[model samples]
Target: MEDAKLTPRKLATRIGVAPKTVERWLADAELLPHARNRVDACRALKVDEDMIWPKAVQERVKTGHDRELAHAYPYRSACPSTVWGELIAGASTDIFFAGYTNYFVWLEQAAFIETLRRKIVSGCRVRFLLGDPDGEVTRQREAIEDVALSVGTRIRISLEHLGRLGPLDGLETRFSSPEDAVNHVSLSVFRFDHDALVTPHLARLVGHDSPLLHLRRQGDSGMFDRFAEHAEELWDRGVPQTP
Candidate 1:
């Protein structure tokens, strides 16, 4: 108030409120400024409304129901199988999968593999970046899980399935290294065009037990862009499997 050259009486008079009300507002942090009060304060103080009332920032930023960060759906302690089918089947443009051992599950479903093949035939670019089973990062994760060779065995099985798809056009598969920070990743990302399903790894828990986030890009930024960039970085650094 001092910086704004505002005394209680001056601010109250400028906003057409009681000086007592201004005193109350100053005494209590929860006494938020009304919209009109904010406007009056901004003009009188020669400062932005946000500077006068910072709590209302989120209110101003949350433009639409689908446009905010809180719009992401959190699936806690559960990984639904149907989610994969729905996301993959509905994808029209592209599909990118980066996981520890996705093949052990995806390869078992003939329908899923066939659907991917169909998508490839339709000119959709499909990329997979799996963790290197023998990599140091994988070993560390195994220790965290307290399971010996659990991550490595899964990776090897996933690689076998990937090997079968090597001859197919529009399909790319590679293994990502954990040591390479630029390409090193800790989260599992399944991006299908504008929508992405993300699973952030929690300590001492495997991916399946971790919480999942269903994110839809409202515009060209936010969580979608961050995860997409990470996936792309990993993809660029991925080592291709030899035929």
Candidate 2:
């Protein structure tokens, strides 16, 4: 508020709260406004809600599971592309993408192939776990979605992009095994080192429409590790992508 040059009255007016309410919030450090008011105030102040009320944010984390969750998006597309770009740019050891098609990143992320090349050159292990385009699961998903650009086409498109990279050392691709194809197609997990973006597909809904969870690894037995282990198990059982 000070940096934004907003007075209590102005802030309250902007957030649709009483001026006295704003004054009380200012006077009492422990006082937390309603969630909606906090969001509105953050937007009006051009800052993050946590920046203004770290205590409130901390108090909301009731369990170890809650600690692992960094954020939640109503839809995968609701997450900012910059979040993906930053995670990809920042990871040094591991960059694992375990999405069925793994197609949207090619569209949403800028210069992804070059980014992969750089990551591999830096000794990062970059892996893609995709569903086989010709597999029965892909055919079933295509029929279920009934979209113009089918799931198999999307998987093939991702394969084509990966092929263009021409097999960089430290880069790998695999198709999930037949038995695990259903499980693989239902959940998408993309990991960058200790952080991950996960989406569980709803029946009849496309990947973009699925709810997303942004998780940071907090401990060995947290939600992050659970999802990471799931993807790793599928990868272990997967067949290497054939050129």
Candidate 3:
């Protein structure tokens, strides 16, 4: 549109639509193209419909070489069970995390511990950076999320569940100290080898309500590298879980 030097009104005129319709399309990312509107817009812009719409690309992803390369979950509630299960189950090298409380959900699955144990035996290093249960940060988060269960209590629950692993050889858990720059964990990450599952925080919503971005480390510098770097920095300043 910029190359064509067409204003929104001009573009709408060329596409035979109202100028306001173009504004709405630009504002709402979730909006999909209509049957005739897509064709008209593409014809006017002199670009393929797929260039302006993601659904076109998404439909072909299953047949592509890198099927699980990248994904976007609109909301945490919309994520499928297979997404997390496969990401964790397929990790061959290492697993890293930066989360508030990591136990409530995972421990519910009977195979969660068994899976980690098997991964440890296979030489996958497991590292976790959790928020300090007693910190003011946790208190603030609990109040903000308005959950009946507090963040501090959740962390305590996580420790109890993790303790059941019984002196794992290649597992380490750390708590983020106030001094740590990444102590304010607005985003939670779970990186397994070349893939990372990231959930960034949204205002007035609990962690679980945020969307998840599934990133793969393929190119020289991508989302995976960026998130991995952030996780590593947090890990470096994290305090030992027991300490």
Best by the TM-score measure: 2
Tens-place lDDT per residue, model 1, 73-172, is 3443354556666778788889988876664356445566678788999989988888877788777777778865488788787677667666688888
How far is 149's C-alpha from truth in model 2 (Å)? 0.8
Question: In terms of TM-score, how similar is model 2 to the real structure?
Answer: 0.82
Candidates sorted by lDDT, descending order? 2, 3, 1
Error of 1 at 38 (Å): 39
How many steric clashes between backbone atoms does each model show? 0, 0, 0
Candidate 2 runs further than 4 Å off:
1-57, 60-63
The top-ranked prediction according to lDDT is 2
The superposed Cα distance between candidate 3 and the true structure at residue 118, in angstroms, equals 0.8
| Per-residue accuracy of model 2 over 18-133 as CA lDDT, tens digit each | 99999998899888889899999999999987888998788877675688898999999999999999999999999999999999999998889998998999899999999988
Q: How does each model score on lDDT?
A: 0.74, 0.93, 0.77
Residue pairs clashing in model 2 are: none
Candidate 3 overall lDDT versus native: 0.77
For candidate 3, report its TM-score: 0.70
The worst-scoring run of ten residues by lDDT in candidate 2 lies at: 56-65
